[model samples]
Target: MGAAMAAEAEYGRGERATPENWMYRPANGWTYDQVKELVLPFDWDLVDGNIVVRGMAVWWHNRVRNRLYYQLESARRRPYAVDSEQCIVIDDHNAPKPDVVVFDETGLDIRTVVQIPADKAVLAVEVVSTGSRLEDRFSKPALYAGAGIDYYWRVERDEDDLPVVHEFWLHHEAGRYVPSPEQPTHTGKMTTNVPFPVDIDLHSLIDG
Candidate 1:
């Protein structure tokens, strides 16, 4: 909580902590290495210079992420890897971590801060939480698209607490995401061919 508060203070400073300071300022370095020390002691993200504390999610959220991870993992071929809660560096000021990210494995570093470049990412998926609905459905898609990321997916919980998946692809000419046509299904299945062929059984994945 101390690190979280410090990061928030730094963000509040606006122009005080410039990119130049990132090279020399000890506090700036601590914020940059949010995961290195236990100071922050939680999952945090930098969003347009603001520090976002990623608190724990509901059981359904974890279950959905795990289910999607394994599904994507089984479909993963050479040169592609599936990861959850990984940070994608949109720019120096913004790096929003997604729930599940599928990225190219070439030139990947397991050590240090694993900041996957937007271009190297095949897809960024966010399972929407009540606290993150706006960022997940709006801010993140815009940021990811603007960064030239190819694909984006949003998983929303319905009134019945069931997962509903939405998929989008980047339209470079428009510099925005174009939503994929909704799949017609009676059993609450979502299917998409972008990034890779993925068929998600939302009902089974959540209810199981």
Candidate 2:
């Protein structure tokens, strides 16, 4: 088995483990420096005062993330920043590490667990993985929408390994994400005008 798979199996598949005070643990009392020092070669996040071990990203996942980050960052204007794999604290108990997060310059902090207030978050993007499908498709969207984030994007790889992007905008009154009128295409490219203008060439992002 691969390193990531081995780690997942050693830890547990997709289930959050209880917080423990170890050198590698990222709890409320731990500093970012400590987290960096101890969690080397492993992906970990702070969720509700607990240290959550995240499954490692496969090569394709990293590739798509890198490409998507570049596209968003290049098009991003002042006051908006695009980041990859940053923790966004949803509350005291939930901080998810999104594949990409675009947030405005408000409530920005210089802490280990950088907190992006829900209102300041313009968009949250999740590139779905086999182990993360349920959380990415349902749990995360609900959490982001409930936190008042305006937009969410879910990217999935089709049978051909090309990306299929789903766009959703929050319906404040309904407190959920309503699919945008512009449906995702199985071919060509995907574009969006909200939060900021971004055009993602699906082919380039995946195969290039």
List clash counts for every candidate, in order: 0, 1
Please give the lDDT score at residue 11 for candidate 1. Answer: 49
RMSD after CA superposition, every candidate: 5.9, 7.5
Q: All candidates' TM-scores?
A: 0.78, 0.75
Give the per-residue lDDT of model 1 (tens digit) for 101-146: 9998788677853578777888998888877888898988999999
Steric clash pairs (candidate 1): none
39: Cα error in model 2, Å: 4.3
- Cα lDDT, all candidates: 0.73, 0.72
lDDT of 2 by residue, 1-208 (tens): 3654554444432233433323332223333233333443467665434455567778878888789889999999878988888767677556677899999975466564355666678899988877778878987898899889988989888888887888898899999998886664435688778788887788898674
For candidate 1, what is the lDDT?
0.73
